[model samples]
Target: MYQLAPNIELLFTEAGDYHDRVRAAAAAGFSSVEMWGPTGVDAPSTPKDLPALKAALEETGTTLEAQLAEPRTQFMIPPWDHSEFFRKLDEGVEIARELGTPRIVVGSGTGFGGWKRQVQLDKLIEIYQKAIAQIDGSGVTLVLEPVNVRVDHPGSLLDRTSEAVYVARGVDSPSFGVLYDIYHSAVEGEDMRAELAGAGDLIRYVQLADAPGRGEPGAGSIDWVERLGWLRASGYDGPIGLEYYPTIESAASVRHIVEVAARA
Candidate 1:
């Protein structure tokens, strides 16, 4: 069976504060939750009170599934500067350790405007290899996310799951993997089965939002029952993150997903 982790950054807007949002998720019966980053800039700024957020998680008995690591700073593509990227990654690792988060999501910046495709890909592999070395024993897994260019994240170099899988395969480290976002894959017109076949065990984390609108599961055209069922059958027994924008009240918007998970 697959576990569900709500992305508190997008969900539980009824509660204005970050810690309160964690509380809201727990109140809604979610035992695990995910977020964009510790800085809170991705959704809101939760930078001031991580201890309070930790306390809320402890109080509510909630566990964090994963979080993005300095998403604003692009590391996977372009100029390929390892200095600032490594610095931010160290900071992110410390925060993850503090919060007991096991995985960190990474974004591949826009493709190099003037570089050759093969050269860019080779450079990306080198960057990730060095990054994996930086966090060699941190016990935190880094997941490279491929955002779709069709509707969101246009100009991004790593917009296809196959490319992410290829990068992960080249890195070939247990600490490195790909973050397979179902919505992004669907928007890219990828056959999930085929792409996932290539990804195999390199998929360390999974996130979801309905395509076309990036809303609640049932709000879009994707078949939640079928796709999620495919995930289970494919041997991916990991948390499926709820990273959608709510179309209705936060709690109400997730009811359909909860039902589907229960039946799944």
Candidate 2:
């Protein structure tokens, strides 16, 4: 069975604060969870009480599979000042260490308008290479997520999994890899098996919501059985993050995926 980690930012909100959500997830029988931004620099995600969050995770014996890097970087924009991103990365690493989180999810913000697509992608490699160096030996794996531009993240630079793989290959660090988000891939209309085959082991992390509405697994048209089978066949044995919005109650929302994943 594939281990599943519901996104705390979207799941278990009924339980109260971020730390309380962690406790709620554990009460609902989840031993793992993921979240966006530690300091709440990004919108839609609020600042977290790191110490309390750490305490809750320890109390629940829950593993924080991943958390997003703060102030999501925008490399393509002109006069590109990435100093803030680099500066906060150290802080992010320290927070991850305290929380016992394993991976930090990164993304390619909206593309630079004037540059060639190849140039922009190569730029990403250069940036992440420097990022990996900045936090060298921090025991943190940085996973680059390729978001879909179709329905969500319309101007995102890294929309294709293949392009992300290319960037990862260029970065060439064991600590650097890709976050193959199933919802984004499906929304972009890429062949899952082929992309997974191409990505191989560079897929350091995974997240999913359903396309059409970015809802829970069974809330959309995806064939969870076939998709999960392809994911299994791809040899990625990582925890899948349920980054979906629940149309139903949070506890009830996960039942479909929990059942499907057990058989997958």
lDDT top scorer: 2
Superposition error at 202 for model 2 (Å)? 0.4
Task: Kindly list the per-residue Cα lDDT of model 2 for residues 30-134, writing each as its tens digit.
Answer: 999999999999898899998899999999999999999888767655577888889999999999998999999998999678889999998888999999998
* lDDT per residue (tens digit) for residues 40-157 in model 1: 5553435637898899888998888998877454644435556877888898899989888999988668755688876776767888899899999999999999999999888888
Candidate 2 stretches with Cα past 4 Å from truth are: none
- Candidate 2, residue 127: lDDT: 90
TM-scores of all candidate predictions against the true structure: 0.94, 0.98
User: Which whole-number lDDT from 0 to 100 does residue 21 have in model 1?
Assistant: 90
Q: Native-vs-model 1 lDDT?
A: 0.85
Candidate 2 lDDT trough over 10 residues, lowest sum? 72-81
